[model samples]
Target: MDLIDRVNEISKRIKTLGTTLQTEEATKNALIMPFIQALGYDVFNPIEVIPEFTTDHGVKKGEKVDYAVTKDNEIIMLFECKKFGAELSPGHASQLYRYFSVSEARFGVLTNGATYMFFTDLDKPNQMDAKPFFTLDMQKFEKQEIDELKKFTKPSFNLDEILNTASDLKYTNEVKKILNAEVENPSDDLVRFFTAKIYSGRLTQPVLEQFRLIVKRAHKQFITDKINERLETALAHPELSVKDNASPSVLLNEVSVELDNGVVTTEEEIEAYNIVKAILRTKAGASRIVMRDTKSYCGVLLDDNNRKPLCRFHFNAKQKYLGLMTDKVETRVPIESIDDIFEHADKLVETLNEYG
Candidate 1:
C-alpha cells in the first residue's frame, strides 16, 4: 500500500486497539513499530531497523534507545519510546539527545505511540534541539502534515535536504501558532499596530477596545468569505449542471436538489466535525464517524444515522454552541475555539463504545 493508505490503516488500528496499549512494550509493538513500518522501513530486519539499539558510550554505558535506524551502517535516526497516554516533553527525549552525540543519527524522534516529535540539531552541532522541529499527532493527520511526513519516508530520505528546510519549518510553525492566537484574541500591541495602519487613532483604552472589536469581526468575516469561496468551488461545478441537451425533468433546479446545495455544511461545522473526529479517531475509524448537515445544525453521527449522534455543531449565529450527544440528548456547550472538542474525549469514547 501507498503512504496515505498505510497511515489510514494505522489510524484505524489506533482507534480499534488504543485502550489495550497500556504498557510501554505493548506501545512499541503495536503503535510505535507500526509507525516505523509505515515510514517505508523494515521493522523485521535488524540490518535496517535495530531494536534495543545501544547508544552506550563514555560514562553512559548500557543506555539503550528503543530503536535505531541505520543506512549503510550509518545511524540515521534514533527513537525513544514511552507508554501510551504518557505526556511527552523534551526531558523524555534525553535518551535520543545523548544518542545523537555519539551516533551519526541526524534525526531523533520522541513518542508516546500517539504523538511523534522529530528533533534535529538545528540550534547547535552535535546536540539535539530542545524542541522538536516537526510534530505529528497520529490522531489528527492533515494533507499538509502527510506531505511533510513523506519527506522522512525511507525512499525519499535525505539528510542535507531535510536540514536545509528544517530551520524554516520550525520557525514557520511557531509563527503560525502566534498568528492563530492573534487572530483569535489579538494582544494590545498587535491591535495598536494594525489599527495604526487602518485607523489614525491614539492608543486610548476606549479606542483600543473599539478597534479590537473591528479587527476581530473583520478577521472572522475574512475567514468566512474564504470558506464560502472554497465551498462554491467544490459544490458548484458548471459541467455537472443541467444543459440544453438534458431532459425537461433534469433541470438546473433538479441538479441543485440532487447536490443538496440548499443544505450546505458551513466551514465552521466542518472544522468542528474534524476536531470531533480527531478526538475520537483513536477509538474509531473514519467510516464510523459520519457527519450529516442541515439548515438548523450540523449533526455528526456515529453510524450515519441520527439515532447514533456523536456531536452536533450549532453555528447558525455569531454565538456558537456544540451539542454533546454522548447521552444521545442535545447538551449544548459554548464553543469559542475549535480546540474545545478535544476536551470531550471521554464522553465521545463512552458514547461510541456504548453504541458499538
Candidate 2:
C-alpha cells in the first residue's frame, strides 16, 4: 500500500493496540519498523537502515540515535525515537540537535511511531534545526498532507529537491507566527511609524488619542474582513442537493450525500466515489479525477487524458443499472468511517501496480 494508506492503517492499529505497548522497544517493534517499511525502505538492510547509530557527541560515549537512513554510503535522514505514549516536547530533541549538526544528514525526524515531525536547518546550511519544518500526525491524516509526506518516501526521495525548498518551508512558518503576534499586538516600530506618518506636524494630546483609536479600529476592521473572507472560502462549495442550512455541523453531516428529486439519499454512493478518487490519485497514468455534483448522487467523470473510465457507485441508482457503466472500469469497495479508509487500501496499490 502507498504512504497515505499506510498512515491510515497504522493510525487505526495504534488505536486498537492502545497504550499497552507503551515502552520504547515496543514502539520500535510495532510502529517504527512498519513506518520504515511503508516508505519503501528495507528494514532488514543494515546498509540502508542502520538502527542504534552511534555517533560521538562531546564526552558522551556509547551515544546512539534510534536510526539513520543512508544512501550511497552517506546518511540522508536521522531519526530519534521516543516511547510510544510519551509526549514529545522540544526538550526531547537535544540528542537530535547534536546528531544533526555532526552528521551529513539533511533531514531529521522525531517520531514516537505515531506522530512524525520533520526538521531541517534554516539558520545554518547542512544542519538540522531544533524546531520541525513540517509535521504529520498519524492520528489525523489529510490527502494534501499525505502528498507532502510522500516527497520523503524512498522511491521519490531527492536530497537536492528537499534542500531546495528547505529554507522557504522553514522560514514561512516562522514568519507567519511572527506576523500573527504583531497583528495581535502592534509593536513599537508600527506605532512609531503610524504616529509619525499621520500626526507629524499637527500633533496634540487630543489628536493623538483620536489617531490611536482610528488606527486600532481600522486594524480591527481589516482583520475582521479577512476572517470573513476565509470563512466564506471554507463554506464556498455548497452541498449539491444535500442541504443549504447555515449550520456548519449540519452541513458537515450532509456533505456526503446528494438528494434527488426531493428524495434524500446516496451516502453510500458518495463514499464509493471518494474511494475511486483516492485510488485514481495513486495511479501514475491516471489524470486528475474531476468529480461532478449530482442531485441524487455524485459522478466520477472520465478524464480524457487517461481515457480510462473508473468505476461508478450509484447510491440511489439500482444495482442492475450500476453495471451499465463501462465494463473496463475498475471497482473499489466502499468504506464507512473516514478512519476505515485503510481496510481495503491494497486496491490503491493495485491501481498503481501497472505503472511499473
Candidate 3:
C-alpha cells in the first residue's frame, strides 16, 4: 500500500482502538511498537529496535529509555512513549531529555500513541528541544503531513533533511506566534509610533482607544474577507455545477447514483460507487459514510471527514437536507455524485461520465 493507504489504515486502527491504552506498557506495546514497524523496523529485533534501550552515559544508572533505534552500533533515534491518553508535555519526558545529552541519537520522538512529535536540537548538539519540529496527529492525518512523516521512515531517513529544515520551522513558528500576539494586543510602543504618524504627533487617551478599535476591526474584516475568497476559490469548479430539473432518469444516465445499501445498481453508479467504496473499504471505520435519496434530495452522508461531522447535501438551493445529528453543521460540499464533486474536471468526472 502507498503512504495514503497506510495512513488511512493507521487512522482506522487508531479510531477503532481509541486513544485510551490503559497503562504505559500497553501504550508501548500498542502505539510505539506499531510506529516502529511502520518505519520498517522489526520491533522484536534488538539490532534494529531495542526496548529498555541503554546508553553509555546518563543521569543515573538503570535509567532505561522506551526504545532506541540503532544503525551500525550507533543509536540514530530515541523514542519516549507515554500512556495513550497522557499529555505529551515537557515534564512527561524529562528522563528522555537527560538521556539525549549523552547519547549519539540525533532525533527524539515523544508520542502518546495518537500524537507523535519529532524533536531535535538546534541551540546545541545532543540537546533535545522541548517543542517538536514536526508533529503528526494520528486522528486526522493529511497528505502533506504524511509526506513530511515519510522523512522519518527508515528507508528514507536522512539527518540532513530534518536538520536543514528544523531551523526554518522553528523560527517560522516563533515569528507566527509573536505576530499573532501583536495582532491580538498591539504593543504600546507600536501603537504610539503609528499614532504619531497618523495624528501628526498628537497622542490622546480617547484617540488611542479609537485607533485600537479601528485596528482590531480592520484586522478582523481582513481575515474574514480572505477566508471567504479562499472558500470561493475552492468551491468554484466547473464540474461542481447543479443541473436544473434533473430527474432520476437523467441522474442515472448522466451522473452516478450510489445508494445507502451496500449495492451498486446502475452502470454510472457502479463506476462511481466503486471509487467511494474503495475509499471506505480499506478503512471500515469510515463505513459511517452512507448514501440516500428522496423525491427532492439525493446525497451522501459523511459521518466525519478528517475527524469532523460534515454537513448534508443541498443542491440547487431547492433540495433541503435534514441530518441525523441536529448540531450546527459546517463545511459541506453539495453535489449529485462523485462525478460532480469537485470544482474542476477531475478523474472523478472521467470515471463516472464514462458510464453515460
Candidate 4:
C-alpha cells in the first residue's frame, strides 16, 4: 500500500482500537510499532529500529527511548511513546530531551500513540526544541501531512531536507491554525481592520457583529473563488501546472499554494463542517462528530466511520445535497446553500440517535 493508505489503515486502527488500548506496552505493540512499519521501516530489524534504544548521559545510565531509527548504522531519530489516553507533558519527553544532544540524532518524536509531536533544534543547535516543530493527530488524517511524514520513511529519509524545511513548516502550520480560527469567528480587531477599508463609522458592538459575518463571508468567498479559479486554470492548461517529472517536494508545494488547500475540505465545506458540529453539539459531544472527505462525497460520522456514514456532503456538484442515514435507511436532501444545514437538524440528530 502507499504511504497515505498505509497510514490511513493505521488511522482506522486508532479510531476503533485506540480507546481500548490500556497500557504503554499495548500502545507500543498495537499503535507505535505499526506506525513505524507504515513509515516503511522494518520493525523486526533490530539494526534499523532499535527497541529500548539507549543513550548514556554521565551519571544517568541506561537512559532510553522506546525506539531509535537509524540509517547507515547512525541514529537519525529517537522516539518516545506513552500509553493511549495518557496525558503527554514535557516530563514524558524528558528522556528524549536529554538523549537528543547526547546521541547523534537531530530529530526526536514524542507520542501517546494517537498524537505525535516532532521536535528538533530550531531554537538552539543540538538541543531539542522545548516546543515541537510539527505535530500529527493520527486519527485526523490529512494527505499532505501524511506526505510530509513520509519524509522520515526508510526509503526517503534525508536529514538535510527535513531540517531545512523544519522551521518553515513549524511556523506555517501555526499560522494556518490561527487563520483558520479567525475565519470561523473573527476577532473584533480583525473585524475592525476590514471595516476600516469600507466604513468610516464608529466601532460599535452592533456594527462589529454586523461586520463579523460579512468579513467571514468575504473570507470564505475569497477562498472559494480563488480555488475555483485555480482549478479552472489547471483544467484548461494542465501543462502550465507543475510537471510530472518534478520532485515530490515540489509537487507538495503545488498543494499548499492554494488557499482552500485541504485535500478533502473546501471553504464552504469547512463552514458546513462547523454547522454540523454546532448542530450535533447537543446530540453528542462535538468531538464525536468526525468529517471524512473523499473524492465522491464528504462523509460525516458519529464514529460510525467511512464504511457506514451518518451523512455525506455532495457539495462538489452544482446542486449540493446532504446525504442522511437513519434506521438502516439512507436519504439525500438537496440544499440551496450551506445555511440550509440547520433545516436538517432533526434528521441529523435522528441519524446520530440511530447509530449511537
lDDT of each: 0.80, 0.65, 0.62, 0.81
User: How far out, in Å, is residue 165 in model 4?
Assistant: 1.1
For residue 7, model 1's alpha carbon misses the true position, in angstroms, by 1.1
lDDT of 1: 0.80
Ranking by lDDT: 4, 1, 2, 3
lDDT of 4 at 215: 98
Residue 275 lDDT in model 1?
80
Q: Which scores higher on lDDT, 3 or 4?
A: 4
- Candidate 4 per-residue lDDT over residues 290-339, each given as its tens digit: 67776788778764344346677889989999887876566889999999
lDDT of 1 by residue, 18-86 (tens): 899889999999899999999989999999999999857789999899999877678888999999899
- lDDT tens string, model 3, 1-356? 44556666666777777546689898777667877788767788888888898764633787788899977677888888888888887677776888888888888888888888778888777798878777788876544466577667665567787788778876765775676676687766767766777787467788888787667676666656654443453366432323444332333322322223333233333344344545444443434444443334334444322222322344435432222122333444445554553332243233223222
Between candidates 2 and 3, the one scoring higher on TM-score is 3
Assess candidate 2 and give its TM-score to the true structure. Answer: 0.55
Residue 299's lDDT within candidate 4 is: 78
List the candidate 4 regions with Cα displacement exceeding 4 Å: 89-91, 227-356
- Give TM per candidate: 0.65, 0.55, 0.58, 0.64
TM-score of candidate 1 versus the correct structure, residues matched by position: 0.65
Best by lDDT: 4
User: Clashes in each model (backbone N, CA, C under 3 Å)?
Assistant: 1, 0, 1, 0
